[model samples]
Target: MNRPQDHLAEQDNVRRVDDVTSALEGLVTVLGQEEDLSVVLRRACLQAVQAVPDADLASITLVRDGGHYTATSTGDAANRIDQAQYDAGQGPCLEAARTGTVQRVEVSEVARRWPEFTAAAGAAAVVSYLSAPLFIDTEYQGSLNLYGAGGDGFGALDAALLELYTTAAEAALRGARRYVSARETVGRLRTALTSRAVIDQAKGMLMAMHRVSADQAFDLLVKRSQEQNVKLREVAEWFVADVLNA
Candidate 1:
């Protein structure tokens, strides 16, 4: 009981949704393969650059100490200029991160509001800007900044496009966090194995020194470790050092 025109509209809507979903899936697949954080950030910045016209460049900064952020990856010349904003902490990039607000400013306008950042940025010939925040929680809001050197820095339509890129960037950041955790876990596991091996070697030295069974040597090592309130690895190290000194 539907008109053909109505059916076509519904199909169009479905196609739009499908396209967005497909793009998102592709982002996940590509980002998941990236082992390094730099590679992930680099891809995210480029994605944002493509989503918004007039955005001559894009960059994503990582949180750092001193209430500051660093440009981890930059998409182009304007983005490289944006790095000075982070170095100075007084432009749309800093403003976006701190207030979690998108800011658009002409080079002249920003010069008034952010003298230091604008001054530093102007030296690199950047003249316009638009920035969005990156949020891990999706609600807390952080920063995803875009830059340009012309008046056409951004427009109303650009906002919607930027949103798509920002969402993808957030997912990429989440993926990078998982990658970091996995590598850390693997490193910890290797350290634990190494610690156990050293402890066993120390245990063997104990058996030789005290002329005791292997089990008795291990028990003696454990008892000493507990009594001294030292770590098993530390106890093993001490034993090795003492034997060497003797």
Candidate 2:
């Protein structure tokens, strides 16, 4: 049966679905466009601030080698909260990262649970908080934290949306990490190749000047390197530079 209220409800549902799709698409675009991990995470936090219901601020925390730091934040409010928690060594974000659990802290319970964080966050006008662990694997773990001015700002739907964001953000972070590692390897290889070419050129110069064989030229460079307590590459560079200057 057709009814005005029913049709309106269906339209609202459709709009909500469309909004979710758009947000996801936008996040994917951000991930694809940003190569710098810090920039990507900063943009991700901004997106969370805009997309999450009742979200006033957002931050991302990365835990590595038994230490934790805030990777990015929407603004000073979020940053201050994260810093307070970090200094205190206890807060919702830390809890989420350590336990891989979602923590939703209500305004009333915040002071009781985390006094230092609550005091700092309350001064910044943040009354509520939610934290979700970002887990791409066992080796890498972090947390996405959101702050709200409203006491009951986040609900079930909000948590679900944040979880979805964290998942996508985690994948993006992993890709960025792999890209960075690969680029570093390529750079190292290039540097090595360049060093080897310079060393060969230095050896050729020695061969011509001293009428020495390749092995003897290489041994001369190594001997000088050991005498000076310097790298073979550095010794070779000195020889090449000396020839250029001469």
Candidate 3:
């Protein structure tokens, strides 16, 4: 069964498909300017926040095991305390992650439902909460939350917008994630290739030092790598550096 206002969420989700084309254009242009992940997530979160009018304090959370970890925040006290709720394992963030749906809590009623979360939030001056789930296909992976100071933090329309923004974030995150992973992998491979050369030079040194054959020296290197539980390239780097620097 759908929520009371599911239709509105559906509309927002459809509208998001259109809105993100512009958002993605901005993202691609920005990517040329800077390639940092924080820069990327920050820009994406800000876009999502602005796309949704009711967001006062916007945040993104990554879901793991029906729990949430703060991905980014709008630099607000309420959103900060929301991080505490995730740490405490009790809050609207968890609820949204668990159900893969929107969750809203007014400040006045929060004390009764989430006593601990509310108390901690009171110290931070947080009074209202709304979160929309972010999904990749049928799998719910994360959420976007918006905090109001208190009272009617989000209306039906606000929830709809929240869902839209969450979807947009999901799309942008997927794109960035792929690019970052590929880039990192290429970097590691390049480094490893360099290390391989250094190791081969070190192996030659070992062969001369022990009066051993090349195959025997290589066996020694592999055995040492297993014993130390470090990468072969690390051992090679150290060996070459010692010889060169000595």
Candidate 4:
């Protein structure tokens, strides 16, 4: 025996879930097109603010070698609060990142736990806070935080929504980092190959002009490079340039 109200409530819940799924799908598409890690991180924070209904502000905090900093934040308010925690060496965001756990702080009890963070957040009218730890094995560790301005702050549904957002964010960020690294490696390899090709061309030209062996021509290039105190690649390039102009 299902009541009409219960049926309507179930329908609304389904609609909310659908909306969240669609939003995340859109986020995946957007992130796929981005190659910069910093842009990806900032987009993740902004998306968190939009995806979670109760989230008024969002930010990310990263920890490395016992040092921590706010990677990106939605606004000055969020950064100010995060910096207070980093300065005082205590806050929900820091604790969540260090312990790899979720931290929830209510305005009423925040003062008792982290007095310094509370003072800063209170001035900005932040009434509630939630931090979800993002961990990818032992390599990457950080926390995604959401701030609420007033009312009851965040309920179970809000926390659950934030968890889902963080899950997607972590995946997108890791993929972006890998893509950037691979692109940089490819760029370096290409430059090395180009340099080698130019140097070989210069060596062949020297051997043909001087009627010398490959070893003797290479030794001559090295001698010129040493005499000019320049890179072997530069000496080779100069010789090739001169040949081209001649």
The residue-by-residue lDDT of candidate 4 on 57-134, one tens digit each, is 888888777888888899998888888788888888888887877788787777899887776555777888899997
Name the weakest run of 10 consecutive residues (lDDT summed) in model 1: 66-75
Per-residue lDDT tens digits for candidate 3, residues 1-246, read: 888689887887667555645665676666667667667766766666566555667776777665567777888664567677876667777678768889877777667777777666557665677877765434336666777765556776667666755665677666666777799999999987788788789799999889998888888888888999998878877777888899
Error of 3 at 171 (Å): 1.8
TM-score, one value per model: 0.67, 0.83, 0.66, 0.87
Q: Write the per-residue lDDT of candidate 1 for residues 1-246, one digit (tens) a residue.
A: 999999997896565445545556555676768777666666666656655656776777556545544444454565556567766767887777778767776777887898887667656656677877777653224577777757655665456556666776686677677778799999999999989988888988988889999899888888989999998798998898899899
Which residue pairs collide, candidate 1? 132-144, 133-143, 134-142, 134-143
* Model 1 deviation from native, Cα RMSD in Å: 6.7
TM-score pick, better of 2 and 3: 2
The predicted structure with the larger lDDT, 1 or 2, is 2
- Expressed as tens digits, the lDDT of each residue in 139-185 for candidate 2 is 56789999888756677667777777777768877887788779999
The best candidate by TM-score is: 4
**Candidates 1 and 4 compared by lDDT, better number:** 4
Candidates' lDDT values, in order? Answer: 0.70, 0.81, 0.71, 0.82
Displacement of the residue 37 alpha carbon in candidate 2, Å: 1.2
Off by over 4 Å in 1: 1-26, 67-69, 136-142, 212-246
lDDT of 3 at 31: 63
Global local distance difference test of model 1: 0.70
Error of 3 at 86 (Å): 3.6
- Residue 204 Cα positional deviation in candidate 2, in Å, after optimal superposition: 3.0
